[model samples]
Target: MRIIDAHHHFWKYTAEEFGWIDDSMSAIRRDFLPADLKSAMDAAGVDGVISVEARSILGETGFLLEHARQNPWVYGVVGKAPLSQGKSAVEEYLAKTLPGADKLVGVRDVLQGSPIEVFSDATFNDGLSALAPHNLVFDLCIYHNQMQATIELVDRHPEQRFVLDHIGKPNIKDNVLEPWATQFRSLAERDNVFCKLSGMVTEADPTNWTAEQLQPYFDTALDAFGPKRLMFGSDWPVCLVGVEYPDWLSTVKTLADGLSESEQADFYGNTVLKAYRIDAD
Candidate 1:
């Protein structure tokens, strides 16, 4: 199927920087570099991956670009920089860091923990403006509650290509999908926006989540964005907190089993290549 894991991460894990890895996520507390992910991808038959930034630091882009340079399977990178500082900072950061980072196809700033007001901030929207000129996709990583504000943000940037990370991070833990589903569909109405079918396991009961519990959310994403705008993502090391790499892949396959061959292709790889503008060659 030419599968590309559209979202995953590579990190030299440390408590200080990866503080989000609370005691519950102890399994992924150690280093997870290209070699570790290579093994997992090989076992799961994943052809390549887009390494998303785990830390919202300037150095993270370079670190991921280095991994992509060293490993052919690391197809592209979703980097991080000072996006909230406004357009000038984004321009300067890209000018300095993007010199040789051809593998860096996108940028992301952690929106999951930010105040909802950040979504409507003019400076942040300006920063998002800076990415369009460079052809960099801006990954939206907000929680489900922030969807309305994000819809506004996406509305502000029609020229920008935005990938909605984790399907707006719906609240699967409590089986709540009201406002999230409504807001999610509204966001998908924008043609420039795309969605990644990753990070669902962690959003659910990590230890006890069943594929059945995740079905509706996936169905919602499929119905909203369809195969063309929806792509598969492992969410990797974070996914390990809930399900093993291979099991997650299996679950996704089962959930998406109704897709025709071409639809499967779009969901698995084609959407990623189109969204990231990754060169298939």
Candidate 2:
């Protein structure tokens, strides 16, 4: 099977732009360029990755696109744009950036910290409306609290494809799963939405987390989306705060051991290719 990491990131890290990388994440304070990720990928036997956006800037998209142009292992990019600014803004951004960006497969805005109302914002939905014609998947990066709002947004655009990043970022630290589990399964009812099995370790108790603690959440995702709609993602440098790349990949492998060979193939790679419309050839 082709082992594509459905999500990861590349960044020329800065304290100013990447303020989210606070002191706790000191391990990743410097920079994580394509070279850094190449080493990790080689170690894990990952075939390629879909490089996701870390900063919400147009330049971030260009940065990823340039890296993709240089690195054949970068299968695709999920970059950011000013989508909340309205439809015209989204269309204009796409017009300027999409011409030569063959690796650009999707767009993401960090909606986890934003107000819930933003999901229902008419202008924002208009921006989403603009993507379907171009066939861009929108990577939804939100907290568990935002799942209902996310469902509402998904209902608005059945034609647009969405890949949920980090499995709604459930509260694994406390082992709390109710509304998150319920809402997650609810969201999965829409075939247009897909989920990434990434970033869970970071959301867990970083110092004392165990595979046992993560298995329930993994089970929830599997039960919700099934293997075909769920994809493997390393979340890379960000995941460094929680666990190493190879360890996380191994954990996911063990968690997915119950799947048949065909199911494993879809979970590890094929699902991402279809969700992002990436050409494996």
Candidate 3:
């Protein structure tokens, strides 16, 4: 299987960006680079990877791009640029590095707790609209609370492609489903929407999550998106809190085991490639 781990993060120090993984999950309290990821990817048969954004000094996609430039195995990057800055900013980025630019695949804003109703904002729309010429995807990192607005944004930009990160950071830890599943199914119903089967283990009971516990949401996403719309992602270093890279990879395998090889291919790599316009070969 030629796997493409679609969502992973990198940072220089634990004390820097990932204080979220402190005393409770001390195992991976250090920086994890491409070198660290390579062995795990090799073990899991991940031929290439897409480096996702790790919150930093802001407008830090340059750091990610530089890293991507350094690594052949890093197929591309879903880096960040503030879309709410208006289309002029977006145009600058497009003009500066639109096509084949350091494997830059998309833009993302971690909208978990931001006070902005970006979906309703003209500037935000202007920002999203700006991405049109660049032909890149958008990585939507939101909480369950943000789904309605996120969905509205998606509806507003039907032509743009998006991958819903961490399955909208559902409350798997509390075992609550209800509105989350319903909303997820609804979002998946959109033609331009895709979901990343990543970060659920951490969302679940950190120390005690079974494959069965996470299966329903995974199954529902698969049902809604079909194999071709769902992409496999490790969520990497963050996944270390509950599971390591290899373990996370196996969890994906367990969820995907029922599908035949081709369907598995879509979930593992093809869907992400299609979503971001990356070449598989």
Please tell me which predicted candidate would have the highest lDDT against the true structure.
1
Q: Which window of 10 residues has the lowest lDDT sum in candidate 2?
A: 78-87
Report the error of model 2 at residue 180, Å: 0.7
Models sorted by lDDT, best on top: 1, 2, 3
Single out the weakest 10-residue window by summed lDDT for candidate 3: 93-102
* Superposition-based RMSD of candidate 1 using all C-alpha atoms, in angstroms: 0.8
Residue pairs clashing, model 1: none
The residue pairs in collision within model 2 are none
Give candidates' CA RMSD values in order.
0.8, 0.8, 1.8
lDDT of 2 by residue, 1-281 (tens): 88999989888877899999888889999889888898998899899899999888878899989999999999999998788788899999899999988889999988998998899998889888888898899999999989999999999999999999999999999999989999999999999999999999889977789998999999999999998899999999999988899989999998888999999999999999989988888
Candidate 3 residues lying further than 4 Å off, grouped into runs, are 14-16, 19-22, 56-59, 97-100
Query: How good is model 3 by TM-score?
Result: 0.93
Which regions of candidate 1 fall more than 4 Å away from where they truly are? none
lDDT of 3 by residue, 1-281 (tens): 67888899887774757666668778777878878898888887788888888773445677778788899888888877657788888787667665557599888877787664666899878888777567778888988878888888899898888889988988888888878888888898898888888989878977999998888878877887898989999998888888878878888788777899899878888988898888758
Q: What is the lDDT of candidate 1?
A: 0.93
lDDT of 1 by residue, 1-281 (tens): 79999999999978899998999999999999888888998899999999999988989899999989999888899999787799999999999988888898999988987898888888888888999999999999999989998999888999999999999889999999999999999999999999999999999999989999999999999999999999999999899988989899999999999999999999999999999999976
Q: Per model, state how many residue pairs clash.
A: 0, 0, 0
lDDT of 2 at 59: 85
